[model samples]
Target: MYVAVKGGEKAIDAAHAWLAEERRGDTSVAELSIAQIREQLALAVNRVMAEGSLYDPDLAALAIKQARGDLIEAIFLIRAYRTTLPRFGATLPVETAEMACDRRISATFKDAPGGQVLGPTFDYTHRLLDFKLAAEGEAPVAPTREASQEATPHITTFLKQEGVIQTEVDQGDTPRDLTREPLELPADRALRLQSLTRGDEGFVLGMAYSTQRGYARNHAFVGELRIGTCAVEMEIPELGFAIEVGELELTECETVNQFTGSKTEPPQFTRGYGLVFGQSERKSISMALVDRALRWEELGEDNMGAPARDAEFVLYHADNIQATGFLEHIKLPHYVDFQSELELVRKLRAEAEENLASAAANTVPEAAE
Candidate 1:
């Protein structure tokens, strides 16, 4: 018999140390600071922030560097770090009508009151790789446009005024966070949005794309996509009022979709909503489509068993951190379970051999008789 390995602890520690050394990479050349990754690798930071459900890009960048740019690892770091953050209290509901947007666009309207500002997007750029950017360099400048001080009216609100958009009454105070509490079936808008905000961007995008490909097709039109900073304030119990904690960058998308006329309803346009931690328009837009699709049952429509229509499926499978952890853990040892299965198979084979011998002996007696 072979001796079982006993160096697991030492091996694990050595592997982790080697990983840390690899992440720092050529330390003599100077370590790439977190600030550099936050500013220069903005796109990667955005991806981490989107999935981590946290607003700080600097923290996300640091997590990425620490994780050796293994994105799933970085996401896990953000999620774990965010869980420990002390929640002083809930902030006042952000007024999207006054987002102070860096980017705002509505496909439902030809010319919105604020005028569509496509700020800091790669939408129109060709997909050519620039060799000049191989070495780190400064980004080119774009002329800044003057922002309006007056509050910009929402496109959905305009539709609501004219009875075009379906009006859902406010449900008093907002719902609880799903992370802190166990997820109950039939989650409210707040919980649903929270789950989607931290969901895998690719998975969410595929689900949204599936809607277009005839699975619970909602005929969605992007009502608006806005990204900007908003003030976060928490109420102090002793002070009896909310104070500004800080500011956070957010991306909000609203979708207009078709609705059905039921026994108690009239045919009207419905809504799908998505909101995320950063200026992630693509993720927010995808999230909005998927959100609306999931509401098919609540809206009194047919449950077509679409991926997006399954709330449990979407909510459970959307987190990359959980997915990757479970996935990679399979690489770890499972010798005890394997040995049990091996023993069971050996016992079964021995029983089968005994039975065969008994049967053969009985046959020989019958032949002799």
Candidate 2:
């Protein structure tokens, strides 16, 4: 029961004013700029872009600043803002093979076609924090290298060539956009990938972790993980040709899972693919694992009754925006509904007490006799 409470316009306005004041903080302290957030807090901006399904780093940074460093709140702001934008035509699919990779690594092989290029990553850094960063001195410049023009072939291609991995078949159908259309159950790989890419990082990570803990345990090896910039092309109606619209920073992950074979079919490795906006390696890897787990039916494997294996459960609960909305609705004025539940509980307790008293009285009379 949603009872409309009236007459708090002034209070609401004052509260918003106070919030703005608090967001500004002390007068003596220097205010943070949007550029500072965009550059320094790049990871947060990337997360907001990935989950919000928007690729604008500037807008993401602005949202972060507006949200006072709360990432989920920032994502919420980005998502709300995304609704007002006009729909443009879809771009051509990005080619990861021709990506100008900043970082590329394969755990499955000792070395791959492109070789390992470990770019701006904290993988090798010590966990200890450097207090020198607090003093705000000039930071040491990182060594630069000439950008490689060579194409980095996908690691899964090698396995596929060896006839060890299952090959993917392109249906040449347009993928359904959940943003434009409502998500129906029994979603295809394309729809599932879309959901996972835009899904809550934490939720998806948890689901992926669940699979690793023997819940539909598929032995997955990271075939390749690449982060780089790729050109985006868009088709022009007048020219009848696609033109390069922009470039996007993306992280792509490919996982080679355990081989599946039967009496008739030969053993072949199954593959899981993940691609997301910006340099979101963790999210991409998690997406791959969950993607593989969800493919139990398609892969002709037995359903292990795992939450990750349940497409409906995973897809429905994966979105943080939807989950947050449903969860936060309880915080709103539910006075009528709560009061009804409270009254019912009290009535049941009172009835039980009355029954107990009646039984006690009957027992006392019997004892007296």
Candidate 3:
């Protein structure tokens, strides 16, 4: 049982006041507006939205401003605010084939259908920093092309047609919300994907990297990576028909792993899928790798005793909010617990000294005899 300690309210209030003052540093300088943060620090805002499980750019920017540019703190703030929101309804499954793509690329096929579109990427850029952006400058305009009206089908579709890749069959079951329901062991693919999409980026990346280092390695090849805006539709109770609620910018990744087949079954390439909010390509790829590693059981592969394969460990530890809460709580007052441990250690030492002294005394008498 935990007891609340009194008499520190004033100190706590003072600390909060100082924090606020620190957040608004240098009053002489122009304060950053929410718009500026939302537009300029987009990637950071995307990270906050992805991890916080919230999608409001304005609110994310506000959280970033309030948290003094701390992404994790912004995510925490967003998540705390999300609890007060009313749930209207769940959206239907998004169709990525209909996505208005900004960037699309495939590593498996060089001349894949729909062709490659490298949109607003840092992949081809040199590592050198541009000093011109150090001072005030006008926003640079980018070159544009005529928007294509063609639908960009997934590369996996072609592979599936050739019967080279494993086919995915929807069970038609309502996916369990990890936020609402307790995460049970032996989680389904849907639950695992939900957890991973909102999971800590660094943690997921590390787990994925472990797989590449031969810990439950699946020899993954990026079949397709696409970033685009997809329409989110929801069924309105009053209307009785599904309507577009909003559009969400998403990054989708499909990885083709080594052929896994048994004597009874023919060899077919397995697949690992990842879908995340915003242009989080790295996170999406990492998620796919980790997802594939966890699917060893379903794929009928041997357990390699990898951390990535341990579903419970990955899911539980992947949540930064929960991990940080437990970690930061250790900084709180534990005087009673510490005192108990201190007393026990002192008693043990005293008893050991007494026993040593008694043994010495008995040995001295025996030596004299």
> What is the C-alpha local distance difference test score of each model?
0.83, 0.90, 0.90
lDDT by residue for model 2 (76-178), tens: 9998999999987889888889999989999988868879988988899998989999998888988987556678899998888898988888988999998
The 10-residue segment with the lowest total lDDT in model 3 = 258-267
Q: Which prediction has the highest TM-score against the true structure? A: 2
Report the lDDT tens digits of candidate 3 across residue range 326-367. 999999999898888988999999999999999988884446
Descending-TM-score candidate ranking:
2, 3, 1
Instruction: Report the Cα lDDT for residue 124, model 3.
Output: 97
TM-score of each candidate structure, all chains considered together:
0.89, 0.95, 0.94
Worst ten in a row by lDDT for model 2 = 258-267
Error of 2 at 308 (Å): 0.8
TM-score winner, 1 or 3:
3
- Candidates 1 and 2, the one with greater TM-score: 2
Residue ranges of candidate 2 with Cα displaced over 4 Å: 1-7, 262-265, 364-369
Query: Which residue pairs overlap in candidate 2's backbone?
Result: none
lDDT per residue (tens digit) for residues 1-369 in model 1: 424679989999999999888877887898889998898788789889888867788899999999888777898898899999997567788766777788888898889877898887888889799877977687677796755545777889888999977788887876887768866777876788888888888889988999989888768999999887777777788999888888777889999997766665679998889988777888999999989998876677877877778889888888777788899888778777778888899999999999999998888444565
- The regions of model 3 sitting more than 4 angstroms off are 1-6, 263-265, 364-369
lDDT of 3: 0.90
